[model samples]
Target: MILKPVPISAEQFTPFGDLIETGSDPIAINYGYTERHHDLASLDLLEQEGRPIVSIFRSTPLPQPVTLNVMERHPLSSQAFIPMGNQPYLVAVAPAGEFDASKIRLFIVKPGQGVNYHRGTWHHFCLALNAVSDFLVIDRSGKGDNCDEVTLVEPITVDLSDCEESTAR
Candidate 1:
Protein backbone atom coordinates (compact mmCIF):
# COMPACT_ATOMS: atom_id res chain seq x y z
CA MET A 1 0.00 0.00 0.00
CA ILE A 2 1.29 3.45 -0.89
CA LEU A 3 0.14 6.56 0.97
CA LYS A 4 0.61 10.17 -0.13
CA PRO A 5 -0.14 12.87 2.39
CA VAL A 6 -2.65 15.62 1.67
CA PRO A 7 -2.40 19.18 2.98
CA ILE A 8 -4.46 19.46 6.14
CA SER A 9 -7.61 21.55 6.27
CA ALA A 10 -10.16 21.71 9.07
CA GLU A 11 -13.06 20.47 6.95
CA GLN A 12 -11.20 17.57 5.40
CA PHE A 13 -10.00 16.39 8.81
CA THR A 14 -13.33 16.86 10.59
CA PRO A 15 -14.38 13.22 10.46
CA PHE A 16 -11.34 12.01 12.34
CA GLY A 17 -11.05 14.89 14.80
CA ASP A 18 -10.34 18.59 15.27
CA LEU A 19 -7.59 20.54 13.57
CA ILE A 20 -6.56 23.21 16.09
CA GLU A 21 -5.31 25.73 13.60
CA THR A 22 -3.46 28.65 15.11
CA GLY A 23 -3.48 30.44 11.79
CA SER A 24 -7.18 31.18 12.11
CA ASP A 25 -8.69 34.27 13.63
CA PRO A 26 -8.59 34.38 17.39
CA ILE A 27 -11.01 35.86 19.89
CA ALA A 28 -9.62 38.97 21.55
CA ILE A 29 -10.25 38.99 25.26
CA ASN A 30 -9.14 40.61 28.52
CA TYR A 31 -9.50 44.04 26.95
CA GLY A 32 -7.97 42.87 23.67
CA TYR A 33 -4.82 41.71 25.35
CA THR A 34 -5.46 38.06 24.60
CA GLU A 35 -6.25 36.17 21.42
CA ARG A 36 -7.93 32.91 22.16
CA HIS A 37 -9.09 30.20 19.82
CA HIS A 38 -11.39 28.79 22.39
CA ASP A 39 -12.80 25.27 22.70
CA LEU A 40 -11.29 23.97 19.54
CA ALA A 41 -11.41 20.32 20.45
CA SER A 42 -13.52 18.10 22.63
CA LEU A 43 -11.36 16.12 24.97
CA ASP A 44 -13.55 13.07 25.33
CA LEU A 45 -11.83 11.23 28.10
CA LEU A 46 -12.80 8.16 30.06
CA GLU A 47 -15.00 8.66 33.10
CA GLN A 48 -12.26 7.44 35.38
CA GLU A 49 -9.81 9.96 34.06
CA GLY A 50 -6.45 10.95 35.39
CA ARG A 51 -5.06 14.45 35.29
CA PRO A 52 -4.12 15.49 31.79
CA ILE A 53 -0.47 15.06 30.96
CA VAL A 54 1.42 17.82 29.23
CA SER A 55 4.76 16.94 27.74
CA ILE A 56 7.13 17.77 24.95
CA PHE A 57 7.76 15.18 22.28
CA ARG A 58 10.86 15.77 20.23
CA SER A 59 10.70 13.62 17.12
CA THR A 60 13.65 13.22 14.83
CA PRO A 61 12.97 13.89 11.18
CA LEU A 62 12.26 10.94 8.92
CA PRO A 63 13.39 10.70 5.37
CA GLN A 64 10.80 10.97 2.67
CA PRO A 65 9.31 7.78 1.18
CA VAL A 66 9.26 5.94 4.49
CA THR A 67 7.48 2.71 5.21
CA LEU A 68 4.70 2.57 7.78
CA ASN A 69 3.97 -0.78 9.37
CA VAL A 70 1.80 0.05 12.34
CA MET A 71 -1.08 2.21 13.53
CA GLU A 72 -2.47 2.82 17.01
CA ARG A 73 -5.35 4.33 18.93
CA HIS A 74 -6.08 5.45 22.46
CA PRO A 75 -9.44 4.27 23.59
CA LEU A 76 -9.44 6.22 26.86
CA SER A 77 -8.73 9.74 25.70
CA SER A 78 -8.30 12.25 22.92
CA GLN A 79 -4.77 13.33 22.01
CA ALA A 80 -3.51 16.71 20.84
CA PHE A 81 -0.22 17.65 19.20
CA ILE A 82 0.82 21.28 18.86
CA PRO A 83 3.91 21.93 16.86
CA MET A 84 6.42 24.12 18.69
CA GLY A 85 8.17 24.98 15.46
CA ASN A 86 7.06 25.93 11.97
CA GLN A 87 7.91 22.72 10.20
CA PRO A 88 5.75 20.41 8.16
CA TYR A 89 4.82 16.92 9.39
CA LEU A 90 2.77 13.96 8.31
CA VAL A 91 -0.40 12.69 9.95
CA ALA A 92 -2.01 9.41 8.92
CA VAL A 93 -5.35 8.33 10.26
CA ALA A 94 -8.21 5.88 9.84
CA PRO A 95 -11.68 5.85 11.30
CA ALA A 96 -12.66 3.80 14.33
CA GLY A 97 -14.01 0.22 14.27
CA GLU A 98 -12.47 -2.58 12.18
CA PHE A 99 -9.52 -1.17 10.33
CA ASP A 100 -9.93 -0.73 6.63
CA ALA A 101 -6.75 -0.19 4.69
CA SER A 102 -8.60 1.81 2.05
CA LYS A 103 -9.98 4.21 4.63
CA ILE A 104 -6.64 5.54 5.70
CA ARG A 105 -6.16 9.26 5.12
CA LEU A 106 -2.83 11.04 5.23
CA PHE A 107 -2.38 14.73 6.02
CA ILE A 108 0.62 17.01 5.67
CA VAL A 109 0.45 19.70 8.32
CA LYS A 110 2.23 23.01 7.91
CA PRO A 111 3.53 24.93 10.87
CA GLY A 112 1.03 26.73 13.14
CA GLN A 113 -1.38 23.84 12.83
CA GLY A 114 -2.16 21.36 15.60
CA VAL A 115 -4.27 18.23 15.67
CA ASN A 116 -6.60 16.56 18.12
CA TYR A 117 -7.48 12.95 17.54
CA HIS A 118 -10.81 11.91 18.92
CA ARG A 119 -10.72 8.92 21.23
CA GLY A 120 -10.28 5.65 19.35
CA THR A 121 -9.17 7.33 16.14
CA TRP A 122 -6.57 5.09 14.52
CA HIS A 123 -3.44 7.05 13.65
CA HIS A 124 0.23 6.72 12.97
CA PHE A 125 2.91 8.15 15.22
CA CYS A 126 4.36 11.61 14.55
CA LEU A 127 6.33 11.84 11.29
CA ALA A 128 8.51 14.91 11.39
CA LEU A 129 9.77 15.98 7.98
CA ASN A 130 12.31 18.67 8.66
CA ALA A 131 14.74 19.21 11.51
CA VAL A 132 14.14 17.60 14.88
CA SER A 133 10.75 18.98 15.91
CA ASP A 134 9.14 19.39 19.28
CA PHE A 135 5.41 18.98 19.85
CA LEU A 136 3.34 20.01 22.84
CA VAL A 137 1.21 16.97 23.56
CA ILE A 138 -1.81 16.98 25.83
CA ASP A 139 -3.64 13.79 26.77
CA ARG A 140 -4.67 11.44 29.51
CA SER A 141 -1.87 10.48 31.90
CA GLY A 142 -2.97 7.73 34.23
CA LYS A 143 -4.57 4.34 34.69
CA GLY A 144 -6.16 1.74 32.42
CA ASP A 145 -4.97 0.34 29.15
CA ASN A 146 -5.06 3.32 26.79
CA CYS A 147 -3.57 2.09 23.59
CA ASP A 148 -4.31 -0.43 20.86
CA GLU A 149 -2.07 -1.22 17.94
CA VAL A 150 -2.33 -2.95 14.59
CA THR A 151 0.51 -4.05 12.42
CA LEU A 152 -0.49 -3.78 8.79
CA VAL A 153 -0.46 -7.05 6.93
CA GLU A 154 1.30 -5.12 4.22
CA PRO A 155 3.24 -2.02 5.12
CA ILE A 156 2.30 1.26 3.47
CA THR A 157 4.92 3.37 1.75
CA VAL A 158 4.54 7.03 2.73
CA ASP A 159 5.71 9.15 -0.17
CA LEU A 160 6.13 12.88 0.28
CA SER A 161 7.61 13.50 -3.12
CA ASP A 162 4.72 15.48 -4.56
CA CYS A 163 4.88 18.00 -1.77
CA GLU A 164 7.76 20.38 -1.19
CA GLU A 165 10.71 18.38 0.08
CA SER A 166 12.67 19.20 3.18
CA THR A 167 16.23 18.43 4.22
CA ALA A 168 16.21 16.20 7.25
CA ARG A 169 18.54 17.26 10.07
Candidate 2:
Protein backbone atom coordinates (compact mmCIF):
# COMPACT_ATOMS: atom_id res chain seq x y z
CA MET A 1 0.00 0.00 0.00
CA ILE A 2 1.18 3.50 -0.78
CA LEU A 3 0.61 6.27 1.76
CA LYS A 4 0.65 9.97 1.12
CA PRO A 5 1.32 12.17 4.09
CA VAL A 6 -0.87 15.10 5.02
CA PRO A 7 0.11 18.12 7.09
CA ILE A 8 -0.15 17.54 10.82
CA SER A 9 -2.79 19.38 12.82
CA ALA A 10 -4.35 19.08 16.26
CA GLU A 11 -7.85 18.46 14.94
CA GLN A 12 -6.90 15.75 12.49
CA PHE A 13 -4.54 14.01 14.93
CA THR A 14 -6.83 14.03 17.96
CA PRO A 15 -7.81 10.38 17.79
CA PHE A 16 -4.25 9.07 17.94
CA GLY A 17 -2.60 11.74 20.07
CA ASP A 18 -1.88 15.40 20.66
CA LEU A 19 -0.19 17.64 18.11
CA ILE A 20 2.52 19.62 19.81
CA GLU A 21 2.72 23.06 18.26
CA THR A 22 2.72 26.63 19.35
CA GLY A 23 -0.78 28.07 19.37
CA SER A 24 -1.64 31.66 18.62
CA ASP A 25 -2.40 32.50 22.22
CA PRO A 26 0.78 32.10 24.20
CA ILE A 27 1.43 33.56 27.62
CA ALA A 28 4.39 35.85 27.99
CA ILE A 29 6.73 35.04 30.85
CA ASN A 30 10.26 35.86 32.08
CA TYR A 31 9.70 39.57 31.56
CA GLY A 32 8.14 38.97 28.12
CA TYR A 33 11.25 37.26 26.86
CA THR A 34 9.58 33.85 26.67
CA GLU A 35 6.19 32.91 25.28
CA ARG A 36 4.88 29.71 26.75
CA HIS A 37 2.47 27.45 24.90
CA HIS A 38 1.28 25.83 28.03
CA ASP A 39 -0.27 22.38 28.47
CA LEU A 40 0.13 21.28 24.90
CA ALA A 41 0.18 17.60 25.79
CA SER A 42 -1.07 15.51 28.64
CA LEU A 43 1.62 13.06 29.68
CA ASP A 44 0.06 9.78 30.75
CA LEU A 45 2.91 8.08 32.60
CA LEU A 46 1.65 7.23 36.06
CA GLU A 47 0.83 3.59 35.60
CA GLN A 48 2.81 0.61 36.94
CA GLU A 49 5.55 2.65 38.56
CA GLY A 50 6.13 4.45 35.31
CA ARG A 51 8.11 7.67 35.38
CA PRO A 52 8.83 10.20 32.69
CA ILE A 53 12.27 10.29 31.10
CA VAL A 54 13.66 12.79 28.64
CA SER A 55 16.23 11.86 26.02
CA ILE A 56 17.62 13.14 22.76
CA PHE A 57 17.14 10.96 19.68
CA ARG A 58 19.44 11.62 16.77
CA SER A 59 17.78 10.20 13.67
CA THR A 60 19.21 9.59 10.25
CA PRO A 61 16.96 10.09 7.24
CA LEU A 62 15.55 7.03 5.60
CA PRO A 63 16.03 6.32 1.93
CA GLN A 64 13.48 7.49 -0.62
CA PRO A 65 10.14 5.74 -0.87
CA VAL A 66 10.27 4.74 2.76
CA THR A 67 8.75 1.39 3.53
CA LEU A 68 7.49 0.30 6.93
CA ASN A 69 7.04 -3.31 8.00
CA VAL A 70 6.51 -2.95 11.69
CA MET A 71 4.67 -0.73 14.13
CA GLU A 72 4.89 -0.32 17.90
CA ARG A 73 3.09 1.22 20.83
CA HIS A 74 3.78 2.17 24.40
CA PRO A 75 1.00 0.58 26.39
CA LEU A 76 2.06 2.05 29.71
CA SER A 77 2.61 5.66 28.84
CA SER A 78 2.33 8.34 26.18
CA GLN A 79 5.28 9.15 23.92
CA ALA A 80 6.19 12.63 22.69
CA PHE A 81 8.74 13.63 20.04
CA ILE A 82 9.79 17.25 19.65
CA PRO A 83 12.21 18.13 16.91
CA MET A 84 15.36 19.85 18.09
CA GLY A 85 16.03 21.31 14.67
CA ASN A 86 13.96 22.81 11.91
CA GLN A 87 13.91 19.57 9.92
CA PRO A 88 10.62 18.02 8.84
CA TYR A 89 9.66 14.41 9.50
CA LEU A 90 6.96 11.83 8.94
CA VAL A 91 4.60 10.20 11.42
CA ALA A 92 2.63 7.01 10.89
CA VAL A 93 0.11 5.94 13.46
CA ALA A 94 -2.87 3.73 14.15
CA PRO A 95 -5.45 3.88 16.87
CA ALA A 96 -4.86 2.01 20.11
CA GLY A 97 -5.76 -1.68 20.39
CA GLU A 98 -5.73 -4.48 17.80
CA PHE A 99 -3.15 -3.71 15.16
CA ASP A 100 -4.83 -3.14 11.84
CA ALA A 101 -2.56 -2.36 8.92
CA SER A 102 -5.30 -0.74 6.86
CA LYS A 103 -6.04 1.78 9.60
CA ILE A 104 -2.60 3.30 9.61
CA ARG A 105 -2.35 7.01 8.83
CA LEU A 106 0.61 9.05 7.62
CA PHE A 107 1.40 12.64 8.51
CA ILE A 108 4.07 15.09 7.44
CA VAL A 109 5.27 17.02 10.45
CA LYS A 110 6.70 20.40 9.54
CA PRO A 111 9.26 22.34 11.51
CA GLY A 112 8.12 23.72 14.88
CA GLN A 113 5.62 20.88 15.27
CA GLY A 114 5.82 17.79 17.44
CA VAL A 115 3.62 14.83 18.36
CA ASN A 116 2.53 13.11 21.53
CA TYR A 117 1.13 9.66 20.99
CA HIS A 118 -1.44 8.69 23.53
CA ARG A 119 -0.78 5.54 25.51
CA GLY A 120 -1.33 2.43 23.40
CA THR A 121 -1.39 4.25 20.06
CA TRP A 122 0.50 2.20 17.51
CA HIS A 123 3.14 4.24 15.70
CA HIS A 124 6.24 3.92 13.59
CA PHE A 125 9.59 5.27 14.72
CA CYS A 126 10.81 8.76 13.92
CA LEU A 127 11.26 9.32 10.18
CA ALA A 128 13.71 12.12 9.51
CA LEU A 129 13.69 13.64 6.08
CA ASN A 130 16.38 15.41 4.01
CA ALA A 131 19.13 15.04 6.64
CA VAL A 132 20.07 13.89 10.09
CA SER A 133 17.86 15.37 12.80
CA ASP A 134 17.56 15.44 16.54
CA PHE A 135 14.35 15.17 18.61
CA LEU A 136 13.65 15.62 22.27
CA VAL A 137 11.90 12.41 23.25
CA ILE A 138 9.78 12.24 26.34
CA ASP A 139 8.33 8.89 27.37
CA ARG A 140 7.94 6.39 30.16
CA SER A 141 10.62 4.67 32.21
CA GLY A 142 10.50 1.76 34.66
CA LYS A 143 7.76 -0.20 33.06
CA GLY A 144 6.71 -3.79 32.52
CA ASP A 145 6.75 -4.37 28.81
CA ASN A 146 5.62 -0.93 27.78
CA CYS A 147 6.50 -1.51 24.17
CA ASP A 148 4.46 -3.75 21.88
CA GLU A 149 5.46 -4.35 18.29
CA VAL A 150 3.65 -6.03 15.44
CA THR A 151 4.78 -6.90 11.95
CA LEU A 152 2.49 -5.65 9.24
CA VAL A 153 0.95 -8.23 6.94
CA GLU A 154 1.92 -6.00 4.07
CA PRO A 155 4.56 -3.29 4.00
CA ILE A 156 3.45 0.31 3.54
CA THR A 157 5.30 2.56 1.12
CA VAL A 158 5.42 6.32 1.70
CA ASP A 159 5.92 8.73 -1.21
CA LEU A 160 8.18 11.57 -0.18
CA SER A 161 9.01 13.21 -3.46
CA ASP A 162 6.78 16.16 -2.66
CA CYS A 163 7.90 16.25 0.95
CA GLU A 164 11.54 16.55 -0.08
CA GLU A 165 10.81 19.55 -2.20
CA SER A 166 8.69 21.20 0.48
CA THR A 167 11.03 20.71 3.42
CA ALA A 168 14.31 22.48 4.05
CA ARG A 169 17.21 21.02 2.13
Candidate 3:
Protein backbone atom coordinates (compact mmCIF):
# COMPACT_ATOMS: atom_id res chain seq x y z
CA MET A 1 0.00 0.00 0.00
CA ILE A 2 1.12 3.55 -0.73
CA LEU A 3 0.69 6.20 1.93
CA LYS A 4 0.74 9.95 1.40
CA PRO A 5 1.45 12.42 4.17
CA VAL A 6 -0.63 15.48 4.95
CA PRO A 7 0.41 18.58 6.89
CA ILE A 8 0.30 18.15 10.65
CA SER A 9 -2.36 19.95 12.67
CA ALA A 10 -3.72 19.77 16.22
CA GLU A 11 -7.27 18.91 15.22
CA GLN A 12 -6.45 16.10 12.85
CA PHE A 13 -3.75 14.61 15.07
CA THR A 14 -5.65 14.71 18.34
CA PRO A 15 -6.84 11.12 18.11
CA PHE A 16 -3.32 9.77 18.06
CA GLY A 17 -1.50 12.49 20.03
CA ASP A 18 -0.76 16.19 20.46
CA LEU A 19 0.75 18.41 17.83
CA ILE A 20 3.54 20.42 19.40
CA GLU A 21 3.63 23.85 17.78
CA THR A 22 3.66 27.48 18.78
CA GLY A 23 0.19 28.91 18.90
CA SER A 24 -0.71 32.53 18.13
CA ASP A 25 -1.56 33.38 21.72
CA PRO A 26 1.75 32.88 23.45
CA ILE A 27 2.39 34.39 26.85
CA ALA A 28 5.15 36.96 27.12
CA ILE A 29 7.69 36.07 29.78
CA ASN A 30 11.21 36.88 30.94
CA TYR A 31 10.66 40.63 30.59
CA GLY A 32 9.10 40.13 27.17
CA TYR A 33 12.23 38.49 25.85
CA THR A 34 10.66 35.08 25.66
CA GLU A 35 7.25 33.97 24.48
CA ARG A 36 6.08 30.77 26.08
CA HIS A 37 3.66 28.43 24.34
CA HIS A 38 2.68 26.82 27.57
CA ASP A 39 1.18 23.39 28.08
CA LEU A 40 1.56 22.24 24.53
CA ALA A 41 1.63 18.58 25.46
CA SER A 42 0.59 16.46 28.39
CA LEU A 43 3.34 14.10 29.43
CA ASP A 44 1.85 10.84 30.63
CA LEU A 45 4.60 9.25 32.64
CA LEU A 46 4.70 8.06 36.26
CA GLU A 47 3.14 4.69 35.59
CA GLN A 48 4.75 1.58 37.01
CA GLU A 49 7.70 3.58 38.34
CA GLY A 50 8.06 5.23 34.96
CA ARG A 51 10.04 8.47 34.84
CA PRO A 52 10.58 10.93 32.05
CA ILE A 53 13.96 11.01 30.34
CA VAL A 54 15.20 13.52 27.79
CA SER A 55 17.59 12.64 25.01
CA ILE A 56 18.70 13.76 21.55
CA PHE A 57 18.19 11.56 18.54
CA ARG A 58 20.31 12.41 15.51
CA SER A 59 18.62 11.08 12.39
CA THR A 60 19.68 10.96 8.78
CA PRO A 61 17.38 11.23 5.78
CA LEU A 62 15.64 8.08 4.69
CA PRO A 63 16.02 6.64 1.21
CA GLN A 64 13.58 7.80 -1.45
CA PRO A 65 10.14 6.19 -1.56
CA VAL A 66 10.38 5.30 2.09
CA THR A 67 9.11 1.89 3.03
CA LEU A 68 8.11 0.89 6.53
CA ASN A 69 8.01 -2.72 7.67
CA VAL A 70 7.64 -2.29 11.41
CA MET A 71 5.87 -0.12 13.98
CA GLU A 72 6.53 0.47 17.69
CA ARG A 73 4.62 1.76 20.67
CA HIS A 74 5.34 2.91 24.20
CA PRO A 75 2.66 1.38 26.31
CA LEU A 76 3.78 2.91 29.60
CA SER A 77 4.20 6.57 28.62
CA SER A 78 3.84 9.19 25.93
CA GLN A 79 6.71 10.09 23.62
CA ALA A 80 7.48 13.54 22.27
CA PHE A 81 9.88 14.51 19.49
CA ILE A 82 10.91 18.12 18.96
CA PRO A 83 13.16 19.01 16.11
CA MET A 84 16.33 20.85 17.06
CA GLY A 85 16.66 22.45 13.64
CA ASN A 86 14.50 24.17 11.02
CA GLN A 87 13.87 21.12 8.85
CA PRO A 88 10.83 19.14 7.84
CA TYR A 89 10.18 15.52 8.70
CA LEU A 90 7.62 12.76 8.38
CA VAL A 91 5.47 11.15 11.08
CA ALA A 92 3.73 7.79 10.68
CA VAL A 93 1.32 6.67 13.36
CA ALA A 94 -1.59 4.46 14.29
CA PRO A 95 -4.12 4.60 17.11
CA ALA A 96 -3.48 2.78 20.37
CA GLY A 97 -4.61 -0.84 20.89
CA GLU A 98 -4.64 -3.67 18.39
CA PHE A 99 -2.06 -3.32 15.63
CA ASP A 100 -4.07 -2.76 12.48
CA ALA A 101 -1.99 -1.91 9.43
CA SER A 102 -5.01 -0.26 7.80
CA LYS A 103 -5.30 2.29 10.58
CA ILE A 104 -1.89 3.80 9.98
CA ARG A 105 -1.67 7.48 9.07
CA LEU A 106 1.13 9.67 7.74
CA PHE A 107 1.89 13.31 8.40
CA ILE A 108 4.35 15.86 7.07
CA VAL A 109 5.77 17.86 9.93
CA LYS A 110 7.18 21.20 8.94
CA PRO A 111 9.80 23.19 10.79
CA GLY A 112 8.93 24.63 14.21
CA GLN A 113 6.50 21.77 14.79
CA GLY A 114 6.81 18.68 16.97
CA VAL A 115 4.66 15.73 18.05
CA ASN A 116 3.73 14.00 21.29
CA TYR A 117 2.35 10.53 20.83
CA HIS A 118 -0.16 9.46 23.48
CA ARG A 119 0.70 6.39 25.51
CA GLY A 120 0.42 3.18 23.49
CA THR A 121 0.12 4.96 20.12
CA TRP A 122 1.88 2.97 17.48
CA HIS A 123 4.42 5.03 15.52
CA HIS A 124 7.50 4.93 13.40
CA PHE A 125 10.76 6.58 14.43
CA CYS A 126 11.94 10.05 13.41
CA LEU A 127 12.07 10.44 9.66
CA ALA A 128 14.47 13.23 8.76
CA LEU A 129 14.19 14.74 5.34
CA ASN A 130 16.61 16.63 3.07
CA ALA A 131 19.54 16.20 5.48
CA VAL A 132 20.64 15.01 8.88
CA SER A 133 18.59 16.32 11.78
CA ASP A 134 18.48 16.24 15.55
CA PHE A 135 15.35 15.78 17.64
CA LEU A 136 14.85 16.35 21.36
CA VAL A 137 13.18 13.15 22.47
CA ILE A 138 11.20 13.01 25.71
CA ASP A 139 9.82 9.66 26.81
CA ARG A 140 9.56 7.18 29.66
CA SER A 141 12.43 5.47 31.43
CA GLY A 142 11.61 2.67 33.82
CA LYS A 143 10.89 -1.02 34.15
CA GLY A 144 8.40 -3.47 32.54
CA ASP A 145 9.36 -2.97 28.91
CA ASN A 146 7.64 0.18 27.66
CA CYS A 147 8.34 -0.49 24.02
CA ASP A 148 6.57 -2.99 21.79
CA GLU A 149 7.41 -3.64 18.15
CA VAL A 150 5.48 -5.44 15.46
CA THR A 151 6.68 -6.39 12.03
CA LEU A 152 4.13 -5.71 9.32
CA VAL A 153 2.95 -8.57 7.22
CA GLU A 154 3.05 -6.25 4.22
CA PRO A 155 5.40 -3.30 3.95
CA ILE A 156 3.86 0.16 3.45
CA THR A 157 5.40 2.52 0.94
CA VAL A 158 5.28 6.24 1.66
CA ASP A 159 4.77 8.26 -1.50
CA LEU A 160 6.44 11.64 -1.42
CA SER A 161 5.48 12.69 -4.91
CA ASP A 162 2.86 15.11 -3.64
CA CYS A 163 5.26 16.79 -1.22
CA GLU A 164 7.53 19.64 -2.13
CA GLU A 165 10.21 18.54 -4.53
CA SER A 166 13.06 19.92 -2.46
CA THR A 167 12.15 17.97 0.67
CA ALA A 168 10.99 14.85 -1.11
CA ARG A 169 14.50 13.83 -2.11
Runs off by more than 4 Å, candidate 1:
23-25, 165-169
Error of 3 at 15 (Å): 0.6
lDDT of candidate 3 over 83-142, digit per residue (tens): 999889999999999999999999999888999999999999889988899999999888
With candidate 1 superimposed using the best TM-score fit, by how many Å does residue 69's alpha carbon deviate from the native?
Answer: 0.9
Question: Where does model 3 exceed 4 Å of error?
Answer: 165-169
The per-residue C-alpha lDDT of model 3 at residue 45 equals 86
Q: Give the per-residue lDDT of model 2 (tens digit) for 1-169.
A: 9998888889999999999999989999999999999999999997999888999999998787689989999999999999999888999999999988999999999889999999999999899988999999999899599999999888899977666565656
- TM-scores for every predicted model: 0.91, 0.96, 0.96
Candidate that beats the other on lDDT, 2 or 3, i.e. the better one: 3
Which runs in model 2 stand beyond 4 Å of their true positions? none
How do all the candidates rank in terms of lDDT, highest first?
3, 2, 1
Minimum summed lDDT over a 10-residue window in model 2 is located at 160-169
Candidate 1, residues 1-169, lDDT tens digits: the string is: 8888888899999988999876467889899998998888887765465668888999986665678888999988899999999788889999987888789999998888899998889999988886889999988877888899999999899877787654232
The residue-level lDDT of candidate 1 at 84 comes to 97
lDDT scores of the candidates, listed in order: 0.85, 0.92, 0.92
